[model samples]
Target: MTFPTPSSLVFRQLFESESSTFTYLIADRTHPNEAVLIDPVDSTVERDAKLIKELGLGLKFGLNTHCHADHITGTNLLRAKFPSMKSAISENAGSKADVLLKDNQTIEVGQFVLECRATPGHTDGCMSFLLKDQQQNPLAVFTGDALLIRGCGRTDFQQGSAASLYNSVHTRLFSLPDNVSVYPAHDYRGFTSSTIGEEKVHNPRLSKSADEFKTIMDNLNLPKPKLIDVAVPANINCGVH
Candidate 1:
């Protein structure tokens, strides 16, 4: 396939079928060979690596949106392959990431810079990565589990608070331009993307008032993730024993 213009970005949305996880690969077309992977799954490392090689891109960083409860991250494995490539996660996550990303901290990928936005609540350290064009216009926001297409992440566990999640979404994500694309970490349905405007009005759980949102979240009574017992601990140590 042809690449994008030098001033643009090369973007790919990869998936891990088992966990319904979405991993994003983003690179600056000006330096097409340098890239970053977000929310990578341990089971998909080989596939991700092969795809990176085929695209002639060097994996420069492995970033986790948060400490996931469903699957272990591929950060350590990617770092093993590319020692210089950093591993990053939100400081609140308490993961052993090479870089503890804070709100507004910038990460470089070729000529593209990813700005971290603190979007906790689904998890204490959840983050959303925002990318802007040279004109400083909104491009896309990688909303981990914090913000989904028509729904939001479950706030029943992992130090989650529905009130905090509601506040974060409104103040941090909904405040963005209406057109900014939203790429979430996982989607149970077949949806590929959504826009901030869509979620603002359509998100069943979070679009409601904070009090209503909390009531809904509190009553979800959802079952815990099947892998939480194993995944949580492994993820804390970057998936290493």
Candidate 2:
């Protein structure tokens, strides 16, 4: 599923089936040698590395939107494969990384610049990365788990707060232009992406009032993630342990 991206940018969305996680590969077409990978899964490092190498791209950063509990990150493994690559995550994520980012920070690779927005809900360190075109118009947003296709991430643990998530979506994410595409970290419903306008009107959870959203989240009764016990601790150390 390809979203409409600018001709100046090279983009690919890779999936890891075990966790249903989506890893994004983005680079400036003018500087294909420098590329960024977001939300890479540990098990698919080889696959990602091969793609990067095949494209003749020099992996610059292995970025995680938050400290994931469902799967270990591939940042460490990516660094091992591409020695110059750096691992990055939100400073508030309570995770170790080569670069600890903050809200509103910008990471530039060639002509592409990613604006980081702190959107904590599923976890205290969750972030969303926004890309803009030459005219400064928003192109797309990589929403780590704050907002999904039709639903949102579970806020039952890891300092998850339903109210906070609700506020983040309404204030930070929903504020973007309706045409801006939304790419989430994980999707269970086979959805690849959605538009801001689509989510605003159609999202079952986020479209509701704050109190109603909270009530819905509270009654979900979802099971704990299978990998939480091992994945969380390993991710804190950048997924090497």
**Model number with the top TM-score:** 2
Query: Which lDDT tens digits does candidate 2 get at residues 71-125?
Result: 9999998998999999999999999999999999998866878899999989999
Q: Give Cα distance to truth, residue 6, candidate 1, Å.
A: 7.4
**Given candidate 1, what's the lDDT at residue 22?**
98
Clashes of 2: 0
- By lDDT, the best candidate is 2
Misplaced by over 4 Å in model 2 are 1-3
Query: What tens-digit string does per-residue lDDT give for candidate 1 at 1-241?
Result: 1222234678889989999999999987678656999999999999998888788788778999999999999998888777777888999998888889999998877767788999989999999998766656668899999999999999988999888888899999999988888999999999989999989999998789899988998898999899999999999998775
Estimated TM-score for each candidate: 0.95, 0.98
**Residue 185 in candidate 1 has what lDDT?**
97
Question: Which runs in model 1 stand beyond 4 Å of their true positions?
Answer: 1-7
Q: Give the TM-score of candidate 1.
A: 0.95
Estimate candidate 2's alpha-carbon lDDT, on a 0 to 1 scale: 0.93
**Candidate 1 lDDT score at position 91:** 95
